[model samples]
Target: MKRKLLKFLNRMVLSIVIVVAAIALIVVLFVQFSPQFGGKASKEAIESYKNSKNYKDGVFKNTKDVKLDMSLKDMGKALMGFFKSQPNTKPEHDLPSTKIDSLNIANYKGDTRLVWFGHSTFLLQTQGKTILIDPMLSSVPAPHPTLGSKRFSQELPITIEQLPKIDAVLISHDHYDHLDYESIKALKDKVGHFYMPLGVGAHLLEWKVDKNKITELDWWEETTFNDFKFVCTPAQHFSGRGLSDRAKTLWSSWVIQSKNDNIFFSGDSGYADHFKTIGEKYGPFDFAMIECGQYNEMWPDIHMFPEETVQAGLDVNAKKVMPIHWGAFKLAMHTWTDPVERFIKASKKEKINVIVPKIGDLIYINSLEENEGYKFWFEGLD
Candidate 1:
């Protein structure tokens, strides 16, 4: 009997080993072949980034020491919270959205009009140029469609097919939510140029974006497209799409300046002195899209809360601000409307102008005053 038991135990152990090895092989193959995981920086791309002050020890660094990992206790809390059925993490039903006409974009002459496409994605029309910022338009933000939750709003303001040809797409970092593979694949042929921080062009190159069309920049680096000067500025954020690639690519905020107007796009950031510095260098912005959601006390140094979003606007000397990084995904524990509700409450205290547009509503930058009195669009929704 003892001999029989020993033989059975050995077989069980071997079976377990085989199962584990198969799982490991599957993961390796997926990462290798999946287009959604995106491309990494080639040796040449890494070599070109060697001179950047922020690129050190073979990875990008933030200006200040920021926490990129969570503590064990916080991790436990996050894991437990994930399965605890927290209420209101997402909207109860499909939210409202407006659709735009393709004809309007083809014949566009605008004073820097902006449209918020749910989360951080925006369609900016300025000086006859249509640019997309952090265009992660796919339903699920995960590497695979089955790996993530669908966005709260089931519809987009405009489908990718309906979009007029794009002049450029500006990326701030390589986080899956901000940089999506499917979105880029759909847009690569339609876009003229792609601007991003250092080391991000490799992903585009792998996705078949022409190398000539990709321009990568380090912090404070500036490039021009048509009537605008695109400056890659600093942000207090870490980046990666996978477990191992953290900080391999740089993250940044952006300054878009035309001869007549200036705008700021805070890709993703924690509150830091960089905002004030950006304001000093490219202050007095006509408008700013400030990140204001997916924030938590667990990882406080990476994303900003609502009050901090308001202050960042003031720090950047923005005349009018639109709170973004919310209105779509349930990335944190906060309620669906928490970011905007808190942002408006805080903005009133500072008397900072807030531009709250329904998803897809047009924002004319030349006259922001006309954009006010937007109804609290999320109040009635569950």
Candidate 2:
């Protein structure tokens, strides 16, 4: 009887081991072989990262140590919080948007004209060049449709296919919400150059973008397109598209310097000293587009509160500030309008200039009109 029992126990253990091994193999195959998760950092890329000040021990690190409130208790609270949805998390009616007239926008010879397509997507035409920044125009921000937040707006101002010949596409990071797969695939043929932070070009390469069109930069690295100089400045954030590979790529804010205008795009950053450092290095910007949405107190070090967004704009010495990263997706627990409302109040207190344009509204950088300031477009929506 004892021998028979031992044989049964060994069989059970072997079966369990086989099952676990199969599951592990499946996950590895999915992460390594799947094109949706993007490509891993190549050996050449790894060697290049070895020389970067931010990369160490096979991962990228922020200048300041950031500890998220990920304690077991905090995570439990966060999980519970997801079950309780806030009122007005999404707009009651379809959000308003103006369809893009590409020829008129492209041909208009004037100061920089910016058209916001909700969230961080912006089309900026300046110096006779058209640039798209963080162009995540997909309906959902995720690897799969079943897995992520759906966009608040039903239709985009312009489809990627309808876009004019893009001079460059500036990618902030590889987050699914920012560096979307479908958008990149549609834009590959239309774009002249792809500018992004280090380790991000791997994704473009995997997507079959022309290697010659891709320019990857480390922090403070500057590259020029015609007369426009783009400097990859630091940001307080993290990156990952899968369970593994966290922080394998770098995240950054960008400072675009033109002959007469300086524009700063604070790409999904938290409140940190990097804001002050960037301000000191590239201050008195004519316009600053800062992130001001999808924030939670639990992850304070990753995303900034609306108040901090305004403060960051001030820190960067922005002559005029406009908040992005909201109005597209309900990625947080707060009301959909909370970010802009809070940001407007803070800007008022700090005596900072802010442009609150509606989605798809064209903004002329050289001219600041009263109609552009504090348009409570989201008001009265249930």
Cα misplacement distance, residue 200 of candidate 2 (Å): 0.3
How accurate locally, in lDDT, is each candidate?
Answer: 0.90, 0.89
* Clash count for each candidate, listed in order shown: 0, 0
Model 2 CA deviation exceeding 4 Å by range: 1-33
Candidate 2 backbone collisions, by pair:
none
- Score every model by TM-score: 0.96, 0.92
Candidate 2 TM-score versus the reference: 0.92
Q: Roughly what TM-score does model 1 have, to 2 decimal places? A: 0.96
Worst 10 residues of 2 by lDDT: 77-86
Candidate 2 per-residue lDDT over residues 119-139, each given as its tens digit: 999999998889999989899
